[model samples]
Target: MVGKKSGKALRDEGLERTDNNMDLSSWPQVQAINQKNYYTDYLKRDDQYLAFRLQNEEARTKMTKTAKDRDRALAMAKPEGAEGEAEADGDATMEDAEDTPIETAGSKVIVIHVGSQNLRIGLSSDALPKTVPMVIARKASKNESEDHPEPKPKRVKRDDGTAEEPENLFGEEWSSQFNRMSADLKVHMRQNKRRMLPNSKEMVVNFNRRTVPETISEHNDPMRVEWTELSKPPPEYIVGQPALRLPDSSNPRYKLYWPILNGCCNETDYKSKRELFLDISLILEDAIKTQLGLTSKKNWPQYSCVFVIPDLYEKSYVNQVLEMLMREFAFARVCFIQESLAATFGAGFTSACVVDIGAQKTSICCVEEGMCVENSRVNLKMGGRDVTETFIQMMLHDHFPYTDINLWRRYDFLLAEELKKNLCTMDEASVSPQVFDFHLRVAGQDTQKHTFKAFDEVHLAPMGFFEPTIFDNSDKLLGRRKLIERSVDIYDGQSNDPVSTAQSEILTALAPPLPKANGDSQPASSEVQATPARPQQPSALGRLQDQDQTPRSSVAGSPVPETNGTPQAGGANTPAAAPTTQPSHPAVESRDDILPVFPLDNAILTSIAHAARSDEKKMKDFIGGYYGRWRGHLDQWFLDERLRSLRPAFTKDIMIGVPPRDLDPQVVVWKGASIFGKLNATNDSWIGQLEYDRLGHRLMAYKCMWAY
Candidate 1:
């Protein structure tokens, strides 16, 4: 009874004894006891307990700091002077300075933008890319040398055998005819100007015209490099500007080759795929060595590459280029962005209908949210060069001052190109006949200054894009060769060995396979028949059709199944009893089709229609705005008509974005690629060296940001 009586008294007695002992104990013993208790508790607790304690400590610290801030703000009195405002701004700046810098994997990136006319290459840090003409000159073989011997400069002599007085390079009759034609054209243009509707007139204002001081335009004389001035002969292989500068006399010794043509690989020039790739490698190697100043291949491994490809690209072209970068050049990593997407990025637009009129091709694509709508891609086989050729043809017919204009000759080609750039104008106000001077400078010959008169020819040349029939007279169109689409490995169709049926079946599970030939089809085995069918998922098109109430078929002209059956009113012999047929919509011909190429306007409309089928938002974006990148003259009449036609399809007026005055349309794609190069890298989007090593060229399919 005495022992149990005092449970509360015993606790109270123990607490009093502990307090008395603590007051009497030494400090060292007290510290040792506390440390022992902490170690015992630490050993008993799990990681979860420790984590909870750490989180609680963090919360308490944050709350204390916040309270301190609040108290300081309440204690400080607001000041009314500029000094007080400066102090407030300084505090804001200090707070902003605490933010960490964003990390990017583009420090050592090498951005490459390859085009038919030029190859742009530079580091991601470069403000402007180093441009090189996409042309190479190699030593001619023995057969080529035999076939194209050097031609001695020929002088036209009169029948009397004495050298005739230098005739007007422009024949007298030809000059007279052109002079009259120019006058007539001027009259017609004036009449057309008068007929233009007042409401349709474009109002242009030059607010800075008076403020802008007139500066004297300086003309630099072309550098005279005589053959005798050269201490050594040209190198065995010449690339870029050097190749373009080679005198016509050197044509026999060197065979000029363009690695790309009409926005694709120039496969027709080379006898084999290996040779084509070799030439491409050589050109790229030269650019990296000379322009980048990375003379040794050893440094290439340290850099990553952002290759800008065409919007309507060939899979083989992408694969080969990737392989060349990762395997041939040993790049650290590789990524690909379509030209349209890169153009949008460079131009800083979230959505646009990119109309890129390049040197040899005009590509159209609708880009949305950094992704290109594949169905909207259209590549025309004509561009700036076509305009140049057409311009030259017009000049020739109009008694051009330079009658010896042969595009095959380097000097003549350069002179014609220069003339085109200087004279061509899209503005109607600038189309009056004007006298322009050009200095014809050919290597190993004296520079000759010639004055020429240009009228409608300047504007008419660029009109070839709208009225393509004008290009029919040019040799480029007549002599154009059809190039076979190149493929690799399994796609090449050269393999004699049969493809594995098991692999085909696996692919079929993912997507419907192409119909097999009657001879290729094999009987299924009992084991194959016994296997259970995998659940089939609806395809994108199928799902879209499902959402739509209208009966539809995947292929045009294919019969649609009748969901609601009704007995025919007519007998079996009647026409109504026969199966009803849906009229087939005319298919848009492919690039390889023998039919005429689709017109630009129709192509754009078709692209928009395809976009509508897949996504309504994307269709709106496609019709929203146009970003034109044309170096040559743009046909305003055609463009305006296209816009007018599209107005009914959209509620809002379509916009055509005008590029900044300082931006060069020719290099916009390259600039976009540079922008992409600076973006933060993602493992799934970029193909690093390790991934390339494991997957080879196939890495593009898995790692490419867009659908491969």
Candidate 2:
């Protein structure tokens, strides 16, 4: 407001003046001036502000220069050796990077492997996951507490001293007698007619001989356990190991349930989808709280999770699980990996035919590199539990010592499972009848020793996989349960057209009349002719009208009039109407449409054939080995024999490689999940809460690593 001063006068007074009055909020020079004034004032009045400003200045001076700055310095004739020394320092830093702990999200990562029988959970840094039986025992209501009367125990058969002892068939004397009998039988068969011409070329078979130990160790008895009856009242809920150990006597107080069955959600067992989801949530929450020591909900936001899903998975199942982890558990972020891919990672194989036989389901898929081959996935709705039930049936038929055995009971179920593991063998050496003794220990009862002999029962029990018909004879529903149907992806929209019902009905009713078969054509009615004709174009329903066809009336919901085979007065220029038909849509094939069960050998061959259709190299690589969670009774040779017997032509060039004996197949999937969890690139693939909130299910299409 004062009188304007000259430039030299303003310089002398250290003051500046301007005539322009427009807003300078966006002006860089004005901003610099204001910032400098604020900084100076704060430096004088605030000690913290002064210290912060000094620290920022020091950091700015030490920061590395940009390319432009380096080029300018070189133009000024600075030393060239400085750039080389800087690069040398960077190289040295990279070389020593191994000693530095990788700064990654893995430290806060929790890997969860949810299986039908067990739930494996642990941090990414853990050497092994904490395994818990995927079972829950809910407290029963008063109405559910009615108990059934227990059956009386069967009387044990006494070994009478009057019977004569049979000759030992496994001793040396019996072997000599068998050889003599075989020689006489061979002579009689030599005179039989030749079935076919002999091969022109001699076929040679190579066998890898394994040395047997000179001193065999005694088989340890697995039947020494004593089952103690629970005397206390059941809690609100039981999970994991304790749930499995609940005695049969306490069955009236609790109801046992397995939330997952046959590699899919056990929705059929629950009242609604909500209840099934609730149980699954409770199981995971309990496992995380007790096993991972994460008791506080507030701390959950600090951790991320990686869920392992099936190779042939349902989109809805995966979506529901992700929602549960994110919205219910409040995890920071979540990611998913396929089981077959994870198995390949854990086994350190670039490509392999993964035959993952779990407690309730067996999944076959060929994984190359890190991706699973499409169409090669086959999920069989049968596994170890089927074998267990089959074994129990076989034993019962042979008058098993425990005649009152009920597999539904906890004790008897455990007993049968243990007996199958102990007595079953695929080796030809143990094909003869063998005597096995098991000590039956019931809660609140005396221990009793029971002796039984098994001949082909042990062998036939495990053969249920190859001969699935044996499972049909048992009470268990084999391959009856269907997988959850996959929901339509949000990105694909709906399968049906978006036309309104009323609009479609009106359009159908107003459809033009069909013309006669002769060359002559009838003219349209006066009402149709009176309406203003618009340019012909495709309708909203995506149907196109031909120019030669009769023009349709624009009036909505109009009814067709009776022509009585008479032509209109002004008729001759109209063209004949073409025949119109409804568009046909192809039926969409779902998971339920496919067969749910495949024999062991057939599944392998089908999987290889599927791979061969895509890439022959992948098929050859997959046929090289069969990697899976095999039991002690089912060896590689057994699978090989089944393949040869089922399809001799297919097995002609196939050689199945055996995995290392010491490699535990049980934890292979879990280990692979852990490996995926530790990957630095996983950070970018995780779906965070903010992203999910904005996109919802649509986020899966963009963020999911696999084919969503």
Candidate 3:
């Protein structure tokens, strides 16, 4: 009791007498203790309150859980149910569909709308993203130096049976090594024509024996790097534009570096996607800086972009693009889509059939009822650039290729795209030869005239505006491959194998009966080869087919990589090149069947197989048209009655209690649209274009609306 009293007295004295118990370094440090305590006192009070609230929350959570358990137990133990249920028993885990809980892990992942080019990066937000496209660029350059040389690949033969080394086609150490060899060859020719490499020692002695070092110095003479033009190598680009690094139009065909972007429209190897990406990224970054004035030195390309690329983008080209982005743009996420899909998505709600006629290529995506008709996607290799190429080849045929380009090149293809976009009509007979004679100035000179009838004869069989015939001649050159896949061959050899109803169902569902008629199901007993659950079993000769193997460790049907620089080849586990062996009897020629206009290339191919010989040409035309129809299909997806039902029934707002302080409760709780709709609505862009005023009459049961 006495000790306790003494301790209390000391505490009291310390609190009352401030400076007496405080630490003092010399003298000035005494204030540090006072300053620290003064600030900490208010914090200590707030911390105690926080601790009390946390304990209260814990107690509340436990009570709530206990109450829930009790209520559940009571319900299970109900007298009428429990006593009567003594007759009924079942497995504990098994449940009806209505009782099944939501499986969060298996929830469908929703795609978000963002920009067009980027890589992954950190954001301050807590939400983990559902999907991200790889936009990172890879680095590639010709490394011919001794210290950092490129690895050599084993030589391989070309399809036509010519063997070539990698260096023969790829770059080599020509600048330094070739120069030395040239000097040696000149010296040898001047002094010792008869002195072969095997006679080097004998020749040195026989040639009046200059010291080896002296000879070497003379060959490597500093004067060799002189002002004379004879020593320089001739430039490589003596003719037309170069080829693409990746097989697109962007990079010139001959440049050392070529990384093509989706929708590229220029020479490939000479320019690169990296160059274009930088221009885009800079525009975005500067726009952000101008608007927000963010001072923090953070990473760049903070958001992401979507890129649409062809299926055959080469590995090296993709890698180079990613490497450049990493080196230049700071950090971003890249999203990849089929260029057709992007155009369709962007234009889906606006047009019934989207025909994206760009500078380099034209694509068709047919949308029926506002959803992308998966079966009706089509991409034509011919674009406005093909028109320009046709014009150039026409000039070449006329012996004025170089002369004409100097007159009009830049605006040529651009004009072609504009023409297709603005002037093209579905009427074939209306397409006249005189339509091409529109005059444009060449290099600001007197107006020059040209006509489509004067089309370069070279492209007569090449530029297929709405048909696959453009590639027919080239494709014919690639004969049937020596090794057709065994699986396809065996599948074809079967006889009396009943044509399964499943295959017919898939094909016929594509063409539903007219509007008032109920859809008919293919009878289960029909005899057709069963859906083998494979796409192809062979490799494309020139079609850039993908190998039928799982990509990395991903399971079958996982989407192909969605990266800005990466190539996309449909779904995972795609077959390379399946044999197309026609069946013996009626399968070869079905007379009365009409092909479904489902707006997809694969669908067209399927339809083409059943078409009459006379109709084959017309079916091929649909392949090119499919790409343009996709937009029309996707535009209608928003009009789906299922989408409309999700919207809030009432337009009026209700008052909840006041939100927590500083909570920025402006969060919009959309009534009907899913998360995707909210995101699409972010800027009132595409979704808003669908006027809400006319939506009243189209309402239907939600499930039936979006259902397939």
The digit string of per-residue lDDT tens for model 2 on 497-611 reads 1122212222222233334588544466665433222211113111211221334321111112223432321212332222223311112113122224435665565566555
C-alpha-based local distance difference test score of model 1: 0.58
Output the worst ten-in-a-row residue range by lDDT, candidate 3: 664-673
Q: Which scores better on TM-score, 1 or 2? A: 1
Name the better of 2 and 3 by TM-score: 2
Q: Say which prediction, candidate 1 or candidate 2, comes out ahead on lDDT.
A: 2
What's the candidate order when arranged by decreasing lDDT?
2, 1, 3
Q: Write the per-residue lDDT of candidate 1 for residues 104-221, one digit (tens) a residue.
A: 5455888899889889998887878999999888777532223434211122445685543323222343234334544554566667663332222111111111122222222344
Ranking by TM-score, best first? 1, 2, 3
TM-score of 1: 0.61
Q: Which has the better TM-score: candidate 1, or candidate 3?
A: 1
lDDT of 1 at 449: 65
Q: Highest lDDT, which number?
A: 2
Write down the lDDT of every candidate, Cα atoms only: 0.58, 0.60, 0.28
Q: Which of candidates 2 and 3 is the stronger one according to lDDT?
A: 2
